[model samples]
Target chain A: MKGGLFTSGYGPILIVVVALAVLPFGFSANTTLNFLGFVLIVTLAAQGWNLLAGYGGQFSFGHAAFFGMGAYGIALAQVRFGLNPWLALPLAIALGALTGTILGYLSFRARLRGSYFALVTLAFAEVFRILANASTFTGGAAGVLIPLRIDAANFQFADKRSFYWLALSFVAFVLLLTHWIARSRFGAYLVAVRENEDAARALGVDALAVKLKAITLSGGITAAAGCLYAQKFLYIDANLAFGPWISVEALLAPIIGGIGTVFGPLAGAVLLLGLGEITKTFFTWLLGGAVPGIDLVVFGVLLILCVAFAPRGVLGVLRRILPAFRGGRA
Target chain B: MGVRARAILSHGSMMLKFDIFLSALANGLLTGAVYALIALGLTLIYGVLHIINFAHGATLTLAMFAVFVAHQAFGLDPYIAVFILTPLFFVLGYALQRAVITPASHGDDGNILLVTLGISIIIENALLAIFRSDTRSIDVPYGFSVMEVGPLFLSTPKVIAFVATLAVAGLLWLLLARSDTGKAIRAVAKEKTGAALCGIDVAHIYAVTFGIGTACLAIAACLLMPTFLVNPRVGNAFVLVAFTIVVLGGMGSIGGALAGGLIIGVVESLSGLYFGESLGQIGIFLIFLVVLLFRPTGLFGAKA
Candidate 1:
């Protein structure tokens, strides 16, 4: 285990943690901290999605269902039961895991795979969004306020710096956990199944169990991000929690970074989220207000270009570049 | 509780029930025809290419805008614009498949999916930029006309839409069954290599197949103009329904698409009436899930 901890993935994660710790001091801008927090939250979600879709090959288009479930779960628990946000956070995670397990079991047991799996997930997301919109408990289309402002006891942070630290910690924890899982026995079994399910099954891997476990874990982690998002934003809406745009963003990150790798989400989060912020600022600067729908158009075009040209992603490009440095050393 | 009295009362309630049932069925059939026209293009492309064309909705929207422009600028009827637009769309579709889609189709499903998704995004945003997001409908002078028979009422536009659907579907069926080019297309769908060996131009068949699929949307767009408020995002609603229909019909089965469309339409209409409007979409998804669970091959799909 110690030997495994010394791998390249862990080294970068440690560097990331150190950088995050110093970031607040170096950048006093509250807006910058806010942006960083948003990126970390997105990174967590993307990593969670990569576990299942990238590693397990399940390709879910309904991950937003889990995200929304987590957000609404926390909101409902806090508003109705008078529970603390921290207490409700666990419940939110459990809700996501439960829903993910049920969905995975149903779809996998029925032998749904590939495009069918994606369609089923998408259908569920649509259903959940529609339900969220109609339910008065969800505050209907107007959405629900968090009911409490930032109080440490309430699991809300009043300061952007505090939110950034909280988000950074979560990102670090998830990254470490994901790295550990990728090297564990179960992780090996998952990769085996991904490469060739039939062969993995013949070699005594319970393919269904492995996939279900990955899905459950992925869903739980993604929902945790949702919980954080609700606390940070102090509001929850069906569109924010269950939007198809969230799913697209989640899928795009890992694909652009280096799918099925530990640092993929981190790399992707940096590039995509950075570009996104820059684009927003640029558009606002140039057009007076952000050009409506231009970000999506650009993002969509980027996704196509990435798929066409860089199938292996930026990390893959880095891998190719690293050899040149080693050759120079030699 | 006398037999004659009970029998008479039973007959009276049965007649009343029958009337309600028939009216509901008629309403469902009319809507189903519109759904079938939209779904036909989707299933046709899926059948021939094995790629789920995510841009089908966007393409339909583009055609809708074309009709709207023709109506506003040239004083042509929306229906008349179909004749001009359908063939034009066919050529566009053919070119797209040949130049873009076919190269990406070498069993790499992900590339094709992303490409179509990109196309959808591009078209939708471009339309939004050009036309804005305001709702536009071509309201014919006779759009509000209706036919009444006994106790039932039928909208004239709906009836025409249904007839147009049937005529287009029948024409497609005839083409596939009787025409040599259509036969070649079907052969290519069945076995690409075998068709090529038999001297069929496989690439041309693929292009033509996509052409026919896009042409089907022209009819659907014109039919939908009177009923629906056309806008940049109008396609989003139909995309999901069409996907559900295609999956329920059995992938790559034209007859199955027709049957599945009717089933979904009826189910949606009845659920909307009995339950609520929001529940109608939920009902459609539930049916999709159940079908996937119990009959993975779908109602008319061939065994993999």
Candidate 2:
């Protein structure tokens, strides 16, 4: 609709990024920094998921395929061939995009959509997880650990706050890109395909190609999250890298925050992780003992409640109430 | 010769290999019966509701835990526990759909998916919180008992499960074919709005279908407890395998699910026999992908 960044919706995103970028400075505690770093990484992954599922209408339950690709690709590049993490990062993201292309190609060729598409993607992820677990190329069940080198060149920072900044920068860039996509022709085409594939095809939208591009971009973004994850934790096994947990996390954040919005993933990630910590602490106090799954239980209940009462997610709710508070139109 | 010597001798003989192959086939069929039982509920739910219930696995895990608790706390036999838990779960399943899933999802497919996923998360984690993730199994008197058939010996529990599965399947078929409730369910599944126009209660039918599906899980759990372990996450493995079976049998086809389960079981067994144990698990998922890509309608499913 518009050429310039401000008209295309990047202005507000820039403000949000600037605000988030300064968060680590206010909290020197490693716990807070670590929490914020994780939130940023999850936000990036959720944004990737939202790009396809939220915007493009392709609900992939197997995003772990791309996430694991980025994770293992970068890890192997470093651990197996001794490459710098910085160089390996792009390679890993590319590998993730390539995987998205391949997975998208086969499933779309079959014209699988909706639940069928979701099931197939899930099966594909399980295949990857099984292969990774059984094969030595991924270090088998024992997993891989990156050598600790506390230098900026290695993408490993001596201070945790620096890593938080690095993660925040990546998330900020992705948020801008997402805003741009939302304003572009391709995004319109993607949404059109999502709304009604046959109708979109009738309008000559090339639904398959649009979906393919969306998935590729989505995969690359999610994989960037995976790459950062490997660099942060310095260790990943098949279960950790290719697990259903990350897939769930990637989907849950955007759904909770506000699907199909640029800032939804970020807001959703912060709320979800923050909710998790609060729930865990509250449950432990109430129960007089630490319970491991209380937080997840709360997440599940919250997810259901969100779907039932606030299907549009937190941002949607905020938008509804904000106008009332300001005595203005929504 | 002793059983070990016979096994060693059989390893060198073609006849013995054939015998082993037959035995593996038999084992697969037996295991497939339980798998079919698991998929039976999933396919039924899909057939009527037209939504993939992501909570299927967590429900199974819950049923298995029911069996475990019954056996541990009450000294109830798994078979007896099945009769008790089946009705209990029927009510639970009905309440879940009518009270939670229906009202919350507002009948949107995407919302239904997320709601079920959330329900799964709640159930699975609740089990984890309560049980502490310990893998538990019940010891039946027939646990180690085997029955000799020709040149092979089959586990008693497995044979019993096979018989029980067939009986349950037959009962389910008869109920659907003859009962008024079955007619209503079929009518609703065939055309929801039309069925509603015809004065059939679509919501009630949906709940009933879900109840039956969940009841099947109770039966499957009871049968499996004698041979399988129960843990917070144990149902997830079955859930995937059941999805494969439901797809293979064609969604919404009861008979097809049964046949698909047996076929998957044999394929899994043969592949495990040939390939290493861990990698052999890939055979099921690969088949799932191939079928989804090539034959999404499945062997007996109506064309989408």
Candidate 3:
């Protein structure tokens, strides 16, 4: 089992590393790095979502709140307390976990299950967006720009290569963490809880506690991605951080990839971001200009099609293709 | 003499406060009537289907656009265009329900939600593609006309909207209470298998129920066109508010929907007046959270 898992996982991880190393050299410095950074951050977020919705069986429509909180946590710490970005990173993760815990506790305490849980999560995110938009602390609707000049100590990389490396490291870390968790006892509990909450509870699983644990962990990781996103972009705002689109993208990636699988988010982010870039470039080439909202429309359509036909996702498809690669199959 | 004069002034001041309260109450009622109209279809669909039609706002927008096109192409008044558009929308609703929605609603609530969300995206984007995201509004001849009752002034468009709301609500109530078809719909809403066992055409009624729900949007759109600008994204705001209202009123309760819409409207108006404009939606959301925390089944909802 271990050998099979390592072989299947190594294929994609090796491919990603090789591609990352070769592509930056071939492509434009700014464009390739920017895309890579986006993919990394989104992959991290999608993984978090997969843990909650896909594995834990508690669909949260408001995971963006964690991301936004993470971004704001770092931004606030850096701005107010003169903290280094590296120092602020852990703080953001903690805050993200706290937010997730509060949300999970409140909703779970009320016994809000299934779709109600999803909607409440969505409402919480929306409420956060509204608060972010209204508050002076978050810089309101216009958002905040980090004053840090790019440097190694500040965690702000001066060159695109440095940013790419940092982002890649983050993505790799999240991927490994996800793999570890999936194999752990906690993971089995999550699967049991998802499969049948009542049965799991009957068997002394403490379903709520398991779900809250998954959500807390998921939220923390997602928030870490937000910190990375803020660092990469050098700016943060309510719209960018807490927007419904972020939540939608996070959910879509996992669903499009195989939701319950460890490497599903990575597969999803690559497919989605790749297709999105291709479509964007093609449209730009055709029009000699950009069309606003076309990408969104396409993404929405793709999501619908995927949900309608392939609920199991791209990784699910890959699993079928590589039947010999069934080691880590969820 | 001075004490008597002061007492008279105090009594007069109390009358003024009473007058102000009365006016606010009247305005709240009017606003509530409009909310009822917007939320009625949402409640009906939720009641019968047990699915939240996230695309209800998009359907409303489409119906509004249809009316706009009719008004532009044929030079027809919006009130008159409603007659033509309502049936067209009904048919469209029926086809949509039968073809797209029913297959998706099979035991999986998530699938139903996704499918509707997909339809919403498609409809919204289609509108964006065709209309180019430009805001459109009807320049009605009597849009600004108003009637005065003592010190209170009521806009003609708003009054007409209110009247239309009552008319539509009454018709729906009659259909549900008096008509055989309405009874069948109620039967379906109550119990699908039992309705089928009772020799009711469940599928046909489901399609018709959807059609009726969409037709409610037709009336709502016509009523709103003169007063508000129509845009591709406008549906989103309305959809959120409608959802809040539906949840507040309890899922699948038409009367509850009516009351819930009124409560939301009044809350919105008061919030806007007291807390300023930007905070209005925030206020509503706060109320929604409070309600969800305390009474998830809603105030008027039947016990689950």
- Residue pairs with backbone atoms closer than 3 Å in model 1 (clashes): none
Candidate 2 yields a Cα-based lDDT of 0.90
Best-to-worst TM-score order:
2, 1, 3
**Alpha carbon deviation, residue B218, candidate 1 (Å):** 2.5
Tell me the TM-score of chain B in each candidate: 0.90, 0.96, 0.90
Query: Over the stretch B1-304, how does candidate 3's per-residue lDDT look in tens digits?
Result: 6543454465577776665565666666676777788789888987887777877989888888887787777887888888888888889889988988777555577767767776777788778766768999877798777777665556777788888898898899999999999999999998999999999999899889888888888888888787778888888777767777878988778888888888888888777766777798888777777677668899875542
Candidate topping TM-score: 2
lDDT of 1 by residue, A117-205 (tens): 88788888888898899888788898878786668888877778887888888888888888778878998998898788899999999
> In model 3, what is the error at residue A254, expressed in angstroms?
1.1
The candidate maximizing DockQ is: 2
- Candidate that scores best on lDDT: 2
DockQ of each: 0.43, 0.85, 0.41
Worst 10 residues of 1 chain B by lDDT: B2-11
Badly placed stretches (over 4 Å) of model 2 are: A1-8, A324-330, B1-12
Each prediction's whole-model lDDT (CA): 0.81, 0.90, 0.81
lDDT of 1 by residue, B1-304 (tens): 8443453465677786776676777888888888888888888888877777878989888988988888889988877888898999999889878876766444477667767777777778778866878998876887777777555667778889989998998999999999999899888888989999999998899889988898888888888787778899888778888887888888877787788888888888788878889888889888888887678788776542
